[model samples]
Target: MQLAVNMLLKCSESNLIERIVWLDDQYCYVVNINEASFPYQLTLEEVIESLQNETKVIVEQDPFVISVEDHELTEAELSKREFAWAIIQSIYVIPAIFDSKLRAQLIKEASEDFGVTKKTVRQYLKRYWARGMTKNSLLPDYMNCGKTISQEKSFTKKPGRPTIYDSAIKRAPVTEEWKKIFRGALEKHYFIKSKPSLKYAYQQMLKESFSKKDFQSGVKVLDLDNAIPTFDQFYYWYRKWYKADYVVRKREGQREYLKNYRAIIGSATEDAKSIGVFAIDATIGDIYLVSTLDKNNVVGRPTIYLIVDIFSRAIVGVSVTLMNMSGESVRVALANCFDNKQAFCKRVLNMDIGEGDWPMHYIPHTILADRGSELISDSLTSLTENLNIKLSNIGPYRPELKGICESYFGILQQHLAPFLPGAVQKDFNKRGGKDYRKLAVLNIQQYTQILVRCIIYYNHRYLEGYPLSKAMIEQNVFPTPIEIFKWGLSRGNGRLIQLSSEQIRSNVLPTGDATVTAKGIRFAGLYYSSKQALKENWFSQARIKGSYKIKIQYDPQDVSVIYLRHDRRNYEVCHLVEYQSMYKNVTLEEVRLLQLNRNQQQADFEHVELNYQIQLAQEIEAIVQQAKAEDDSSLPKDIKAIRHNRKMEKELLINSKYEPNNEPPVFHITPIQKNKLSLFQAKQKEALDDDYQT
Candidate 1:
């Protein structure tokens, strides 16, 4: 019953009155919301009387009401909002705003100021008062202006302009019969597997629907000059009847529609409550890399595995290796993800990282991956199952399901790769083109460091067009991956799973069988030993019981250590033995390569060794023949005489001292020193001679 600005009153079902301003205690200025009219003075008593009699009611809603923060203002709405505000801004404070003469003068002044008619100013003022007196109230009524062609209208001639070239030509109205023909032709020709163009479809429709059969040739000819609708008319009806989705599906097939044309119903972050879902994928880096062992050796493109937190779009984990994309590589990347980021950056990269520079280092609750052989392997299954982590594989060829991870790959390969050395250019495969592989400079380790730097930058980079939640917007959270990640950790359920590095490795590392022999525990043709193995006397047992296989987990990236899995979460760490030290700090792949080279070298040397042995045997046979020819058999024929002669030869050989070139003795034989002076020294000595001379 009380009058206030923007207050709504329903005088009837069709009439809505908005109170603009109070003229006095008994009267107030009001405006009709639906029609273009100036503000009119209405008595307060009339509204109160209507309310008392139940003839009018208060309306709470204004149809034109909108929140500026929520709705995007179009250019039309912006122009109107500014125009209305400009007009009302000057006259809204006037004391005699409701006075007819004063209102007319102010309207005239506003019209001149804005280069609009006086009626336009009055209409804008009325709208401002009627629709809650807000800037949005002046927004253009676009919904009312452009109407959908949902219902057909009857036309006498045509509902559009005449032909530009031939206005005098008569055209028939599009009737129900023509509409039926249009639908049939569109479905049969346009919306089909062939997906013929609109013009082609129209020509086909004319040929089939409005053609005459020739008697002699029995060929149907199209009616080009008359009797059929125009392509524009046919297209209009087709658009109205067949929606974009149906058209795409029928023309392009269901798979194409689902993959490319389907509407996005929700966001990747919709179900992500925290750091729970991480999407992992692999790509062959566009740039070729050199070998970590020898820089001159081109290692081809490195297989890069990236783990991204879907909710925050942060690059949580990255792995660059010369190994192929397989379950082992995925495991190594996952292990790195679960390891302490600070220690990893320092130990492997030898680079210092500040606090929160690359803070993502926890295992996510669920991992989303593509249907790669590596991801769907039994090894990955066992690893995730043992660690209580969920693994999900997306449908084949559906990259949009894991869009954030794929987007990062595109950014890296397409956007960032062009600037790097040895990057695969588009024309590299063309005939007589330069080979980009020869330009390789960075090794796997150096490339990984560069990737780390890029990832750190990506994490902290401010995101544009990010879909922030209402609560996050209210809290004024920055739209950066790192900031969003931090916010999610604090605001969400904090589902990131934290575990010891050993526990993660025990489950995630690749597993193989190692034989326990008398000498050592052997794996990959190399020896390993652990304190636990020694304490359990495994080697001694193996010696007694013969060698046996024991299941162990190892890092393919480094062959120095392997884990003996005692149970699900327990492991005994083993290291390479002293004799196997040559394989230390080398990958399993490298070890295999070295073993192959060693085998080839030995094979090459085997023939040479055999030739030397054969020559030595021939020489021995020749010596025996020469001894038989020069035999002294008659000298010692009896057994006792031969034995006596052998003893004499042995004694002579022991007593003889051989010297070369009659020079100083090769063997310096010193006489044994006597405890006291010898008799010869007493008879003649240098010291006695010196005393005599003195």
Candidate 2:
């Protein structure tokens, strides 16, 4: 190997040698780059012998010796390099410059000629030789010239430039205590929910903590003009503690930051290289819907859940219901993704479709969604883990992360919803606007059918400017979603997984707590029964021991059957009870809605029921008042005598009504006879019809 200049040689584990300058075939110059050492001559033969014996190894070239471009140099740097080069131009070529005595004399003379000190001239020569003897190495070290913030000296008074507008008002010093105050004020006033402007917050801080109340023009005013830590001082510390991005997130909220302020850098296709990646989201439909039971009863806007394949931009799943965007809706939508498309389209839309028209019934490898309760739930997490699918929840309020699914809602609203009756307008909340809710004419089922047809049209609609892959372009594939999907499968690019309905339900269904009641297994206000429950006598045990809670997994779309989970693998299928057969095909949302409507109707009759109860109480009070007004003075006061008189009166009244044979006997109570009964007399009279009933 050729021994080049600036090559680092490791003679041992600790010591390093840099070949600085070449002298001759017999002698070469080297220096210890790690430590300060004088340049010395070494024998080329010795270095060669060390290399051959594996004693010294060439590690790498020194980084500082790399050539610098002329354009990279500043004017001042270029001038300095030229000046230093001129001073050492003649003496560096001579061999005598290597001698200590000769080098010192030459450097002294050059320093005098250049009007620089000998020490400065010697430093320039050392830098040049150490940096592979390049002219660029003599440039000034301007990179390390400025003093950093840490290197700045502490100040007694206010730092930075003096104010131009107010010279008399001396700015306050920002002490350690003031910094603590600033932090507390910022967190309390600026970063709080009522998000105030920074300037306003500063003024409020001064008024609340720093200033005293004073009267000005007969009005109470806060004397903040002479307060310690001026706005400038407070603002300086604010910038030090919070960055612009953090300030926006803190004051405006994280949702606002995600919606507007955050950066949009990546595409949905960045990680979705094939059709196995799906994006799922839900939105409230713009059009209001009525109840399927009664079209006159306006239910509300329907929640529409959609799952889109990121690779082909095709919607694979859809669920429309008069429910909120919740876990139930998400589960229903996800279950729909695995349903046979041919049957689903015919059953729901009432329109038959060929297999090629809407062909998507595969479990996705990854499901991307927002941090909704639907996706971030424990049941969903367990389902994804069991199914070997990755559940990715994007940041909160970041709909842009799953743009394909979010944009589909807008497409539906723009294309289908606006033309429908009861569709909401943007200015509906404005003054004197017509109530869009009153115009609702379609029910949930009707609206869902219309939505399904629109989805079918969207799938077949040709994409004009889709970003097709190289293989797709070469294959001359049509830009429609179905065509793109077929093309991807043909090239073996988009691999998908197919699963049976039973398998999918076992892994993907959401679970809840169901009670084993004496009536039956009660879940979502419906009753269910199973042969296993009967064999195990669960209901009898529940009746004897009182009802208890059990874990169960059920599909929200259909309440006809539910799975009783014993473990991960074992699940007992339970059918709806015979008594609850009316609600056999009802959804969990529909059941809850029916319960809510019944509750409202009960509430409507509450006032009339309360009035009836009040009238009954008033009648009882009137009768009690009339009885108290009667002649009770003529009756006996003694307990024994009163009981005897009442029994005689009852018998007399009974005899007069039944026999009518003799005149009814009249009994009068005498005051002298109203004496208490003696114990012996009471015992004696107990045998002869002395039984008194109160």
Model 1 Cα lDDT, one tens digit per residue, 391-433: 7767687899889998898787776676689988878899988
The top-ranked prediction according to lDDT is: 1
**Model 2: CA > 4 A from native:** 1-273, 343-356, 371-382, 392-401, 473-476, 534-537, 614-694
Off by over 4 Å in 1: 1-275, 287-300, 346-352, 382-390, 413-443, 604-609, 612-694
**lDDT score for residue 583 of model 1:** 63
How big is the positional error of residue 206 in model 2, measured in Å on the Cα after superposition?
42
Error of 2 at 564 (Å): 2.5
Q: Write the per-residue lDDT of candidate 2 for residues 314-395, one digit (tens) a residue.
A: 8898988766777767777888897777876554445577877677777666788776766765456545543436777677
Backbone clash tally (model 2): 0
Q: Which number leads on TM-score?
A: 1
Error of 2 at 223 (Å): 55
